[model samples]
Target: MRRLLSAVAMLILLTSACGEDTLAAGTYDGPLAAEGRQGAAHRVVECDDAPTGGNNYPGEYDNGALSDEPEAALRTAFDEAQITGVHDGYVLVREDDDRALFTFTDAGRVRQALIVHDGEAFGKEGWYVESWARCDYAELPAAVAERAGVEIWFDADGPVSTRRVHSADGPEHCGWQHLTFLSLGETTYVRDADTEYAEWTDAPYDSEADLPPHAVDTGFHRDGDHLWRSPDGTRAYVGNREKVAVWPRTKDGFTCA
Candidate 1:
């Protein structure tokens, strides 16, 4: 299933560029807008189970809730899982390119897991997003939960930049699906696959009425920088900042601090 999703995402990224001519010549200098979208709200229509409001889009995405508070929800899940032990450090599990989860555990047993996100893909219209999901150890895809158990610690304090690479027609095409976060003092920047391509504009495409009927206008939080890997490790995300450029993760672009 992972391979299939990756293949499909690559296909989308490759085919998405073919429709670029639909946009007017030159670059779209205007603020990203969902001008022609069909629905009054801004969100991912493909997520049919999502709630009614832009902020509530996650009504039930992939078994997640729009109203779920990351930290609080994780606590509930911990209780249900009957997890017990002293608090341990956090584990950053890369599910895919665009989504990831920060699982806080105790003695290698996952007690709580929160979704780490970039405010770009799954938030408000033209805004950045940082949301979380709470899942029991069993709820997590076996691979991710297992990886968490193995204890892979990501070096978050490394130089804030790294190289991201991709082929014109490969999983890297939808690179926006996988993201890593970096901090430069007060400001934060997220690096991912989408950064490398100009295939899609950061426009809030709420409806198919937009240039591409398939475009869904997502929202995000702007208070800080966010970087998330989609649960599948096939996509990437960063908070929506106007005109943010994507850089390729090639060579030794970044290292552990």
Candidate 2:
């Protein structure tokens, strides 16, 4: 599944060029305003199942609410994530080339001046959006928009700019029956065959022969949905296993870190 996801992501990245007259293969489908996308209301979208939102669109997205306090909240989240090196009186966190999160607070009130964001595509929009606008239902005020420093979003067409909306009822909302798969690229990795790990072993063995002079079978097992085989070819692992890998572009790429 990871390989498949990577393949799809690669295809999307390769096709998502900012050129003209292209059919657009990638779909960072955020809450389409035309379809009444209100995917910015945080703390309200009850993610009971935590499905991937990008499945609906090529790319997934989210937002944060900044009142008079943003810097403090950012510091908290950053510190909690164990990310240091916040010197310029601001904290910028980004994973992979596509995902970014940042916060620039006032002199000290980080929480009150916070502007939260999540799952944003790169190149199209850079970091930091502030707003003084408030939500009536959530008890936010208008000044929030004016105070906001950045806006991140995806659009099919029209005025291209990211804006925050009520995500509790937005298109990016993740739920059951909603398998948002990014049609990235066609996969080439091989799966396991019943007969043997043909991809790893030399085929053409007519008989299930036994050990040949110190040859011992180690067997196969699972390592988190991935299958593994020892270097000596004497033993093998199967079931839930993941091979060491990276995304080349996305953060946690290949999960090496």
Candidate 3:
């Protein structure tokens, strides 16, 4: 009985250590916020879509390819780039002279990866999306329009739940941030704060930040496609061309848990 209990205790200890190793510090991709950037690794290739020669800073770039086995690519790239000490949620991959942060799922799949520009740290603004290549072990996956029982379409048109504002408030025509994506029945909408941040601030309604947090709940007109403050109000995307903004549910909606 004593030997059996010892064996069980050893198994439990191994499991706990494995779990701790897999999960990094933070909840989502924000791991480095607490742990800080690691060693002297740097990025070599730019992660942008447009092609550039070498070692340039402050230019527009495109997002990288979605991968099921992004962790594998990080390892292979590490041989040349030397990325080390990756937590399960996020990893910093460094080239000889450049660095990028790769955010992964708990399962170790790649969610998104971005290049941190020169002079910028891991968590700040200069992180441009990386250019991902399809590996033999995993192919770049498609952007899911629907997940967790919710349907989503971009640049879509038709009668979506909407409301409007007087010119004094906003563009005079904005959908209730939540209604921008046409949903049905009990399907709930969730926002990935890292990806869809404009939903939380008034910055989108007025890029100049001139408005005083005005509410648009009056005029009503629905003509074409639309863009509204993302459900949170972080940034503004294009929304309906109608008059009134009709909110189907409550505003101050839920952010992804």
Q: Enumerate clash totals for all models, in the order shown.
A: 50, 75, 36
Give me the runs in candidate 1 sitting further than 4 Å from their true place. Answer: 1-88, 119-257
RMSD of each: 23.9, 22.0, 17.9
Q: Name the weakest run of 10 consecutive residues (lDDT summed) in model 1.
A: 159-168
Candidate 2 lDDT by residue in tens digits, 3-108: 1123222222121231221221222222221111222212122222221111112233223222222233344434443222121222332222322223222222
Quote the lDDT for 234 in model 2.
Answer: 28
Candidate 3: regions farther than 4 A off: 1-58, 61-88, 119-173, 178-180, 183-257
Q: Which of candidates 2 and 3 reaches a greater TM-score? A: 3
TM-score of 2: 0.16
- Using all chains and alpha carbons, the TM-scores for the candidates as numbered come to 0.18, 0.16, 0.22
Give the Å shift of residue 252 in candidate 2. 29
